[model samples]
Target: MALQLIPLPPALWTSLPGRSSVRTVADVIGSTQPWRPISLTPDLTLNTLLSLLPPAAILVGIASIAREDRMRLLSVILVGGGVSVVIGLVQITSRDLYFFRITNPGYPVGVFANRNHQAALVACMLPMLGVFAGLRQGARAGAKLQAAFAAVAAIALLPFVLANGSRAGLGLAIAGLAAGLILYAGHQGAWSSLTRSRAWRLSAGAAALAGVVLVGAAALYSRNDAITRISSATTAEDQRFQFIPQMTHMTADFFPVGSGFGSFDSVFRSYEPSEALLRTYFNHAHNDALELAIEAGAFGFIVLTVLLGWWATRAAHYWRDMSRDSSARRFGRLGSVVIGILFVASLVDYPLRTPLLGCIFFVAACWMHLEPTGRTQKTD
Candidate 1:
């Protein structure tokens, strides 16, 4: 008998209007800056307006879900943290040392003046990529093919991420992948099985061989004086250690209700020592938890604790339920990877502060919270 495949229903994408003339008109009008008498030139661009849609859509979707899931409280906490970060970003505006110009080139730092914020946003989304990959694994064959297409699209976009030159983001991506692998091993019921299966084992061996070849190539490249010199030309002094202590001290001074959301630059300027080991202005504390505590105060800390607690509870619950359901197991694994990425990334960068990353995290969390409908099939 020939096999027939069922197509997945297009929910969100189908609900949106096609990119027709109406959208173009709306984009133009939205970008126009109007004056009562004398018209000033419009500063807004189409891309800016388009960028706003994701956050607006996420906020609306989250609000709708909050009404029933009892997740509203956590959402409020996230919003508070977000607001605080924005406020701090706003307060530290300056010409020579603008909060927006500190990070790597080409990164958008809405309220943040640092590239790390942009990198953080990218890092947060990396784990979501893993989640989507895992979800696709449980889908029907046709759906799985679509998912593979999406994965290719994601990988294609990776070069942009690499261009940001965020060491923290690189670390987060590696860690998230490792976490995903560990979770997969646990879920599959055997660590050795990952390398024992004929198909998987051959693939793994080939990958190992390719990695060795790549390392050899890199070694050859490093041996070339020109390549070594070019690589060393852009090295920045490690000033994090010196700056971190000052940031720590500043955090201590504003322990309860941080200097107010987005107040880091202002506070850092006031408290920063004259000895000045670091040449650049510190926009974020470089520690997400501390930054949250400093910006949102005690309330923010409490909010963070609650959100983390809820996430932990949900993860544990799903992890337990996944023992029987492979699909749920995949979701659980992806969720674990995301949580791990967030925890590790928080230590070095603040991706949660960027709206793009923040919305992605929020959406992924919502997806993770959803209950699966499929029945478990016994593997034995």
Candidate 2:
């Protein structure tokens, strides 16, 4: 942010990518201006930096809580998700039913501005259902009941991902579901006895048959379903793809130093392809990594590299060490799976840019640090 405020010399400022565009626009508007080259729009840099606070605060709060409360936190999140789903369904009835004025009307946006963001949240939550159900410390009967609830809830949630109308979200939903099932299977030690039991073979075959039935049912159920929309998608591809090649050029134009945080909207004008221009303007690159390159340049890539390395290392350890006997460890592994979902979602869409998903991401990151403990304490 401080870098944005620093007024660099004309030589430095003029050499940057957006300088000519800014100069020409200023001249056209008949305004003489002193240039602050570090960021053509410093206010954007400040605002973008400020946006990180909520997620950072969430991370700190989650990390500070007693390990037991993490599960409670997860439960609260799931409850909120349920409420969001309900609200989204309601939004389908009328545009007036939307929760916010600046929202995608007639779509199931829930508390988000976009349906895809809401879908991403839903997708991320799907895996944690297993963790939530399995992590409870209680009698055998109670545990079984909890598992049943989770099973039903998972079934309920899967259709919403399809109904939400996000192909990326649908894909991630499948991945999250698969990750959860893999975790569950590992917990059951199913891999060790896969070939040893006729019962296992029967169960596997039945599961495969059920999956086929579900897919066929889903395809036939709704015109707006994920499968249907995906199959019927226009061959021309989304306009977002057009922005990528231009964005790649912008990334190179900025090179080591970027236009500045949150500057994509401003700097993008300089490189936007003529054919790609439309009545609607892009606020982001859609592909977050490429956008981040245009905004933060090499620094963004370095930060991403470090974070990815950390996540990979922790995920491998969590997977290897997770066990059915330890709820905390299992929860950690599940959290990793949830984080993976969001990370993959970022490839095609910027899920983390939204506050709700951003906070969830950080909290999930904290969950990766969970340690096994016997005592239970309320989160203050």
Per-candidate TM-score against the hidden true structure: 0.55, 0.86
Q: For residues 177-223, what per-residue lDDT tens digits would candidate 1 score against the true structure?
A: 34434343344444433333553564355445433433344454422
Which residue runs does candidate 1 get wrong by more than 4 Å?
Answer: 1-59, 63-103, 106-127, 130-144, 147-163, 179-237, 277-279, 320-322, 326-329, 372-374, 377-380
Worst 10 residues of 1 by lDDT: 34-43
Residue-level lDDT of model 2, residues 1-380, one tens digit each, is: 56766888665676776467766776788876555657768988888889999998887787788877876788888999989888887877665567566666777888888888998888777778766656544468887788789778888876677677788877777666666565555445444344435544644664564455446657666734667667887646676675677788898888777888888898887677787788877878877888788787888899889988988988876655333335566677877888888888888788889989998888788778776454432111
Clash counts for all predictions: 15, 0
Best by TM-score: 2
List per-prediction Cα lDDT, in the order shown.
0.49, 0.74
Question: The CA-based lDDT of model 2 is what?
Answer: 0.74
Give the TM-score (vs. native) of candidate 2.
Answer: 0.86
Q: Model 1's lDDT to the true fold? A: 0.49
